[model samples]
Target: MKKKLLTVAIGSAVALTIAGCNSSSNSTDTDTNKLLPKDATIAFAGVKAPVTDAEKRAILASDATITTGSDSMPLDLEYNVFARSGDTFDHAVFGQLVDKQGNPLSKEDGSPSIANSNEFTSLLPRGERLFSVSQFESRPGAMFLMELNQNTENGELSVKDAWQIDQSGVNGGWVHCAGSVTPWSTHLASEEYEPNARSLVTGADAAADRYAAGFLDYFNGDESQWNPYQVGWNIEVDVQADSGAAPTATSKKHYAMGRLAFELSYVMPDEKTVYMTDDGTNVGLYMFVADKAGDLSAGTLYAMKWNQTASTGVGAADLDWIDLGHATSAELSDYIEGANQLAFTDIFATADANEDNSCPDGFTSINAGGNGQECLQVKPGMEKAASRMETRRYAAMMGATTELRKEEGITFDPTRSKLYLAMSEVARGFESFKKNGADSSSYDLGGPNHIQLEGFNRCGAVYQLDVASDATIGSSYVAKNMSALVAGVPATDSYGDGVQNPIVANSADYADNNKCHIDGISNPDNVTYMSGWDILIIGEDTGSGHQNDVIWAYDFGTQALTRIQTTPYGSETTSPYWYPNINGWGYLTSVVQHPYGESDSDKDTGNGENRAYTGYVGPFPAKAE
Candidate 1:
């Protein structure tokens, strides 16, 4: 049997040279003036590591203070609420429903036309709508168009009413996760929790299929066409218009981006290239290059294949790209119409056939009855359905690395030219390097062709991948150097139930069993980079032993992390978004989901008390130069 490659958590810092920033004197600092907040009172360059839990407790106990011009405790951006729980958020965006002339539809009152729109209103409070056990239903997730009104007298800025764009999921908006603003000024809303149909249904026998059959219920309405393949594509919303008009937003699912539990998509400066992160177990990192710049409808997809020099999940390694090919939804529909389960199976069997018509080495075969078998290798004829629908399985067939566990948010930092990927937990057979105060070497070579790194721990991590400088469209690329920006200490005990019970340090004075010590950034989830300020906003979604999830700001320059805000107990801080110059002041949007937690009953049926909040933080005035 081939070894399953272990997911490594290696982090090593490199000297960074600021990119695109000009070096000029105070009088001639035009570029500097443009990048810096015009009324910047404090310099927001570096960050400080997280404070102790006791310190955090005291800090939370008191009102957050912002001392202007204070370098030690720099509070550059003042945080404020945009929308709270039960407001217009908590719903999903279907797409930017546009007419023939490409204008957004609206009613006489200027409210978006929800009727003609394709947003599925039924899938809200996702668990209730899909599980079939609950009569109560919740709303889908939504995107807000916030208006920042500048105060004429004090030069302060505040957010006006954030108008609702559109809310429906008819075109596929299930569990809207992390998002990104495209170079063309559009919002890319991603879908999470979409199951893989090929591996879950067709690949298994009736007995095995019965266990996985429930996943087909993820898509409602048309059960005939509704398979695990439909919901997980990157859903784009056109909310990037100017703030003057009641900013109308629309949505569209990019079928070419591959259907998976997407965390987010980051488009490169080149406009045509995009990096999409899959937020699930045993997933792959993908890159999509559009046929035309700024047009995402058609594109080619590729997955990453790692070449490791060491076994530790940490450190530098080379990355090879596997082209999975591409096809549109129309083409896919046609292919599926002509191909049945037996046809799809034959496609794989034909590709799996060697000269002797036997499965290849390292490939496993499972009986599908009546002498039909399925092989775990790339079948040349299976690219179409596999690429866009059964993405993870397709990548595996193409020899791409598939050991990543919960590969969450991916944000590009233009200044450092580095892309940061948050792996919620480092433990999936990866052991810690410093176990019991000594070097414990347990790095193993696992996965196909020894293409995966091995390590330990259930603590989380953020990987800094430095891709090539001149990467072009459709070109295979490698991580020039890959390092862990920050890695949480491995969990001490998980209580034998298999889930990690991270032992966090209570005080900065203490060190042992401090798995959650690095200033409480364990289980890092949604992340985004404020390029102008060089701040990486990281949010958390951790399990027990960790109280409320907090959002942190990590300064790449100082290598320090500071906890910015704490969510309600048992809530996950989500989607830390930054939009510069919203009414001349920078603005951020984040959410706290399922505040105060939820019960099994609450999840099954909608509980009015259990709600998610969409917060708007920022509008900090520019300080004197």
Candidate 2:
């Protein structure tokens, strides 16, 4: 049998093209037909990890049995599956394969543990192979064989099986996290980031920006094209289930989808609007206004920012209609020289806390054509930091030379009008050294400081966001009005049914974190808990790289955060976090919800579309008796 390749949490991404378009104008199409919401936003970043029972309930409760196309379909089985490429996240290979006993398979040494009795056929769905001990056998219940929606001619990894469902395209890559069948009979697949970029980008525009220097590097400059240039986008996959090919790439680029890693997507019962999330951690949060609402083609983009309580400020607003509206390649290079200087300057400051070199030599604003750090950018060398410079030096440590967000996992509740966000576990402390301890001396980042002030929020947590069902809050969540509902406090148990906090060195106070679970809330209006408008899902990784596969829930109305009933991290290759951590591959890629039985998500049935279905990013927690 062939080895199984684990997928990244935030694997692929795509770009939207909805510029000046009003999907409402689709009067030409049948009145029953409507485009998806282009103006969406994700308000989940820098939020604390969940710790209470309520937070855990949100994730488990999301699986309620309501409506279903087939009574025989299993809708409430608490399912989790692995994600593959969607043309956006181009990891080595993606997806999860486990055994019937729920035991995880291994992907060690660049190879998976496949017993001689297992099957190993390349073309999925068609060529059959009986397996005795393969990733497939590790699954709990009956397994569904899904494949990348690309043509066989495209690459070696093509779906050769006689499978059924809907979705396909040359790059008909499926957005792992978010998926929804449109009211118009199409499915919406989310593209997290630009796969072509390959490595994560620490600085947004590499063309000019470097560390945090103010001067340009005359020597060894420009030749490497060290310029931060990446062709990427957030795309929607149209599920033409009728044909084997679904989620067509022809979907328009939602201009409303500001700029960031497109994490998840959701639709409302009204069937005229959609919602999305920017899975970029500590980056931004926002919402968009679809020109015609749901027109996916064109719409106005906006972001949500929080003002101090009673400060009387505008929390949500779209960025200026600048030439390079979204994160465009053109604007990234204008001040190329200035950018490089700024980057190196910051790097130097991190090595040694010398304010003299803190402010680079030539990093003047006027030189970069009005392009500089977006105020929200994190600067090194702070007096009140919790750890050493290595804490904030993500670029140098992780190949993230440009992008700095490891954000992942996002879901939406149309009925409750909420979003559920989760992030990977924190691998290390705020310090560069892989040690975990709370010195409170190196806690200086904008978002990091805010989290420390709040008691509970520690490592590898989840958050909730209050948002409108029709608002565009996904792709542009960076500037969103973010508020931490749940604090990521550690647990009393360490080796229990919970995830581990990667930064254990700084977390001496939180040693017994076994029972510790980063959770979120849902249906906050309940008398016992708080109410959440939408749930945003995201996670943080410990410096160790051991991914903790857990989900958090939240409620917008009561302003409460709940924890989900997650079992624990699987220590095998078949486990959820294996690929992203062990293999040093995959990401918390994307979080999405599709209809039961079929991989299509429909919201018209109402926010109360109480239908049961199984969704997975890993193995299903519903262990069979």
Task: Give candidate 1 misplaced runs (Cα > 4 Å).
Answer: 1-79, 88-170, 199-222, 240-247, 313-315, 326-330, 333-374, 377-381, 429-446, 449-454, 470-478, 491-515, 518-520, 598-609, 622-625
Model 2 Cα lDDT, one tens digit per residue, 1-625:
1111122222222211122221222111212222212222112222233234232112321222211122221112222322321111231122232332223235446444322111111111211211000111111111223343321121111222222111111112222333334444333444443221212234234333332111112111223423222112334433222233422113433323433444444444444334444443332333343434346554433333223232111111122111112222232222222343223233333222225323233221110001112111234542111011111122112111111123344444444444444433222211222223333322232122212221122343443455432222332222222333344444432432144545443343224333343232211111111112133332222321222323343335445443332311221111111111101111121122121112112312333221221223221111101
Error of 2 at 429 (Å): 12
Q: Write the per-residue lDDT of candidate 1 for residues 1-625, one digit (tens) a residue.
A: 1111101111111111222222222221123343443322223332233244322221121112223233223233333433333233223222222222224444459754332111111101111111000000111233444443444332233344444444444333355667777776666777775644444443233124543333222222124543345456777665433324344556677777777777778788778788888776556678887777788888888887766656664434567778888666556654433344223353344335455535668664322111223456546666676677666666766777665667888887876678888888654413223222235322112234332334453557888888664354353333455568887654345322233545645453333423454455678887888755667988777754245466777866677776666644345666777655432334456655555462122322234323444434444332223
Whole-model Cα lDDT per candidate? 0.50, 0.26
Candidate 1: RMSD to truth: 12.2
Poorest lDDT segment (10 consecutive residues) of candidate 2: 577-586
Q: Estimate each model's TM-score.
A: 0.67, 0.40
Residue 362 C-alpha lDDT in model 1: 60
The parts of candidate 2 lying over 4 Å away from their true place are 1-185, 191-231, 241-259, 265-276, 308-456, 459-462, 468-487, 492-625
